[model samples]
Target: MTGAVATAPAARTGRAPAPRPVSPTARQMRRAGWWFLAVPLALFVVFMLLPMGMAAVISLTDYAIIGDTAWVGWQNYARIWDDAFFWTALRNTARYTLMYVPLGLVVALGTALLLNRSYRAVRLFRTLFYIPVVSSTVATATIWYWLLNPQKGLLNVALGWFGIDGPRWLYDSQWAMTAIVLMSVWAGFGTNMIIFLGGLQGVPGDLYEAARLDGANVWQQFRYVTLPSLTRTTFLVSTLLIIGAFQVFDQAYVLTKGGPGNSTVTMVYYIYNKGFGSLEMGYASALSFVLFLIILVFSLINARLNRPGDGGRVRRRRVPAAVPSAVAAR
Candidate 1:
């Protein structure tokens, strides 16, 4: 019995096999993945995150490019309250946004609608329209600058044929901002038009057919069917236009230099002036944060306003159910 018990115990205590070592190929793949991750992580830390942190810290100090730095603790932000020029820049930017956004929407939507249909020339037209978008900002600005020349410009010359006197565009303080708005719309609408075109394609043909079967006119079909479908696209285009309008700098800088009594000075141009022209890096950083906050607020507002819903409440008529003859008889 003791011998049997010993043998049973030995059988139960049999050893398990050892684990296999990792292959060199698997180890090499793991090393390669680490290497792949290392560069981008290092770049994000060095360029993006580090710069943002430094800018935030700098915003609290008085760090003129050539002078001793002093911690001022929100004095720069306080100064923005009293800065009349800053307020003017803000107003100018607001005005540009107001003018640019609506006009851009109309033009982009119109062009998109016109080109949405199939035709032999459609591709050519799209390419031509998108050419301006691909052109550099400097190049477009240069072209517009020549076209807006007060006396010798093509615009006034064209107006002359119509027997209408044209006002000075870029040179006139009253019209400089207006001219800039026109140029901006023309140069930028192509991109949004493409977006609208894409949106138009996604709209179901069955909806339009149903609307027509219900005796809906073209305008009604568009109002009820097309508009609801393009809600997200419109939101996207409007948000982009708002952001671009606020950050307008290249056109104003290249065409007018915020000249003719600063009529065209935008918030971004103001920030650039403060940071580089005046060498007030700390103040510039503070102003930059203020603009950032404004953009963030507007973006949030846009998102809230355009949040998904049923588009509109379209009520369908409900029919009464028919009773069975046997039940009725009973």
Candidate 2:
């Protein structure tokens, strides 16, 4: 009778049992998660999305602070094409990007390589390298300003020890942009170095061991293993460099004021002059969108060039026949 009773439900009904009710603890935790997420989501909407919407609307209107606002409807964008100063600023910004991105990548990757070891003082050196990144941009520029003074600055004084005359960095148009590039690299490379370090650490120990077993030298192992592994990190760093290069304003304003004949005038600096200096908010907004588009295009190009599969395929083809089956498997 007991067995029949136990089997009666399975024989009489085929439907599955209902799900268990939510536990009070789990419900409370779920609510807490939403509450936690709401804070950053609210902040993002308020600070980022709202401002972007406002700028888009403002870009279509002539809204100088002291005058009646009028709808202009793409006139400002049209004007940008005819503005010679805009092109010059763009050219200067491009020149800075060209110099800064490669040098920044090299300095960052080199520093990461040097520090990617177990040592007592490694953390201290990393902290020292990162100090410039956390330091205020204006303060850093001010320091570099003093450092680049051709007459008595530390840089030129060191040059004097080597019997080489240093050029007037900030004061000379020819070297002003280069000086800014150097300062930018020094101030920013620490962040990229940390990123590279993270990427380096993620690389498999087995890959290096296999490379050594295959008679690969230091450079060959780096080329075949480390570089391939770090492709995404490189793309991330380079894209950031390009965007920051375009939006550069603080260092130029603090160090050179876009001068020694506007040689250091960047897109953001020019936009700042238009918006605040000349009270052309609409035009500046238009320029901002244009700069955003440029950044977008360049980032897409960088992503396409650094696609993981593309590099992986090439590397696979390049792997020497002498490499062992174990290395090939990795």
Candidate 3:
């Protein structure tokens, strides 16, 4: 009986024996994949995660560039609440964002609408518009300075034709922010216009055809079909414009120099002054964290407003958010 049991396969088919069962190779391969990810994981930890942790630590201390860093445990944050300069900078940035973003959206959308039609030189026109975005900010600022100069400016000369008094665009505190707003809109509208143009193209033509068949006019079709479809693109463009307006530095740095009595001073310029100019790295670091928090809050508000169910949502982006809930959508 024992011999029969051991030789059952041999007895049945005259085969020597069956080979031992092997483990699933796919599971082993999956296990191998864990090790394969180790390098990239390590790099993310070292480069991204490590730096953020260090910044958070530095934000808690009172370290200057040349002196010892002392931990006062939220004192920096407390100080920020009472800082008038910080408040002014924040207010200025908010005003700048409001002025530029709405005007930019309107102008970009209008331009995009015009360019959506057939044009022979559409490519050239598009390039001409986008040239400023890729050009150096310093160069653009310098050109703007000459164009908006108080006495010898081309704009004021044009104003002379209308017999209307023009403001000293770059010199007067009242007009300084206004001039910056105009320059920002001109420089930035092109990018958003291009984006909107691309979005308009993505809108299917069949909808327009169907609307036309239903006796829909251009305005009606756009109001019903076009706007609904372009919601996502509009949201994306608005968020970008808002963020850019908030973070404005280069133009203010080169043109107004945060002046006409700090009327054009943005939060970033304020932070830069605190960090490098005054050598208060710790205070600057705290300010940097506060700026980060502000950005984070705005970003959250943007995303929340733009989400699918939120009525006025924009397109979801490929870039990750800077704060929590960046993972929630996933």
Candidate 4:
């Protein structure tokens, strides 16, 4: 009888179990989620992906606004190789990125460190620092235009009090880019400061206590504990700074208009001139692709360099013998 029962069950096992039915509410919620995502997805395809596809196609042809559109294959891209202005703009942008990213990082991180405490005054200071970020870029540039005036400007006037002559800021080719860098950093660092402040607040308090117990000084704690903990935040800030520096336009446009021998002409400004000013849409599109590639390369490098599990580039030093092993492990 047992053998017959087992045989009967084995015969029934060949048939699969019926699937469970999903509830009406579960199905409705899933449908609603897709419905919510549809608008953004449609917008993304219409605006971003469509324009990018159009730009890629446009880059392959000589599509001057009023002229006959003719396919030029890769000639437009080849022209970029010999374009002296393109190279100059790229070099100026690189210089700006080098100056702007490091300085901005330092200023933002410094301000964030200073304001990471809990106090009524700290809240006021954070708001004050963030004001420049929300201010209109054109308005900020206008203000800097007067402040950087070579002869009668506030910056030079203050220098005059010290008996040191301030260099011609926007007017001098040598200093035009520098002045723009200064303005860009001052106007933009507040956003990065806020980002860093968030990161600082997220760091585990236990790590600081561990470091303190291990006899770590403030600088040592910052260098080892804080620096390691904030690597991802630093990476994000630096990447944003690099992208922004390459595309800088309003400051250069409002302050210098890419003047003083094209010293402050960024890649985006040059592309704007080609596309709209000169109406070489094909060439401009090609330049834009090149700029995109450059940004992508730099961003990839930054990501690899700051990837988790690598403790960043902070120099390791011997901790005092009295320091605990826990601090050293960090």
Comparison by TM-score, 1 against 4, better one: 4
Predict model 2's lDDT versus the native. 0.90
Per-model TM against the reference: 0.81, 0.91, 0.79, 0.91
* Regions of model 1 farther than 4 Å from truth: 1-47, 309-330
On residues 229-310, what C-alpha lDDT tens digit does candidate 1 reach at each position? 7888988998999899889999999889998899999999999999999999999999999998998888888878776364
Tens digits of per-residue lDDT for model 4 on 118-144? 999999999999999999999999999
Candidate 3's C-alpha runs over 4 A off are 1-48, 308-330
Show model 2 residue runs off by greater than 4 Å: 1-20, 308-314, 321-329
Per-residue CA lDDT of candidate 3, range 203-273, in tens?
87877776676566677567656776777788889888878888899889999999998899999999889
Clashing pairs in 1: none
- All-Cα superposition RMSD per candidate: 9.1, 3.1, 10.0, 3.6
Summarize candidate 2's per-residue lDDT along 243-327 as a digit string, tens digits. 8888888889999999989999999999999999999999999999999999999888888888855543224556777655445
lDDT of each: 0.87, 0.90, 0.81, 0.90
Native RMSD of candidate 3 (Å): 10.0
Tell me how far the alpha carbon of residue 5 in candidate 1 is from the true structure, in angstroms, after superposition.
Answer: 37
Candidate 4: minimum summed lDDT over ten consecutive residues — where?
308-317
Q: What ordering of candidates by lDDT runs from best to worst?
A: 4, 2, 1, 3
The stretch of ten residues in a row with the least summed lDDT in candidate 1 is 319-328
